[model samples]
Target: MDIAATVIAIEFRLPGPININTAPAERLQELPGIGPALAARIVAFREEHGPFDTIEDLTHVPGIGPRTLDAVRDLITVVDER
Candidate 1:
């Protein structure tokens, strides 16, 4: 059925991509799993650390994980030079 097909399409499609390295807390919440607490933590970590080295490095921050990183991997990038 058309409805079933639509659901299938949605299920097969990938979630939105997020940029973790520089996204603001509000923006971070747009991702799949992040909430205000995590978003605030991310901002604080960014402020304290200056900038992130890599997407994987987000896990090293106070409140992130592999799943969280996976959600925003495409959208986040380290813009500044090390």
Candidate 2:
């Protein structure tokens, strides 16, 4: 008798860039290095201050620094819903 082995792989893609202006904490948490605390901060910051004018503005969030911003910059977008 002989046996064969098979390998499989799966890939996931976001429908599009996450809109930082509109994404909820749950959605924002999906970004790399953005955990619950940071995700909440992002939401709160936006609510307190207003939508981000630029992706770089995310750094203004308490926990989001240059490194964290860099990690998710390509995956995020800033749109003015207003």
Candidate 3:
């Protein structure tokens, strides 16, 4: 007689938060829930408007809102050289 079994495991990790002000789109996408389009929008919005004064300011971007902001707040930051 013979038997077969399978096992699986899932894991989640927290990478150090990224700085929104200076991080490239690729790096920005690493934030939870952010994708290529959203990351590009963030960068474009920053370039066209200006560096975000606070995390809440991300609301100005087309896709981000209070909910989305809250979701990734801990995984994002800003450092204004201005």
Candidate 4:
């Protein structure tokens, strides 16, 4: 299934932790507990702080944590530009 399809189709499978380096707010919102505001916060954070080097960097954002990250780990992808 497509990413969106997969995300919404299954309740047990939470959305992935989006890659701060690449995903826009819309994509980031797909994750559980990340609404538009939080998603926007993530995008804005990226704009100010720059690319994320690791998933741990998500904690720098106000709403994320290890639990949230773990919830969505399977769905998120970090693309390496270099």
**Candidate topping TM-score:** 2
User: Which 10 consecutive positions of candidate 3 have the poorest summed lDDT?
Assistant: 2-11
lDDT of 1 by residue, 1-82 (tens): 6999988888667544445666788988886677899889888987888777777888877667777777767766665432
Error of 1 at 18 (Å): 4.6
Residues 1-82, candidate 4: write the lDDT tens digits: 8998876888556444456679888888888877899889888988999877777777888888888877766666656433
C-alpha root-mean-square deviation, candidate 3? 8.5
> What is the Cα root-mean-square deviation between model 1 and the actual structure?
6.7
lDDT, candidates in the order shown: 0.74, 0.85, 0.83, 0.76
Candidate 4 collision pairs: none
Query: Which model is ahead, 1 or 2, in terms of lDDT?
Result: 2
In model 1, which range of ten residues has the least summed lDDT? Answer: 14-23
Worst 10 residues of 2 by lDDT: 2-11
Candidate 1 vs 4: which has more TM-score:
4
**Each model's TM-score?**
0.63, 0.79, 0.75, 0.67
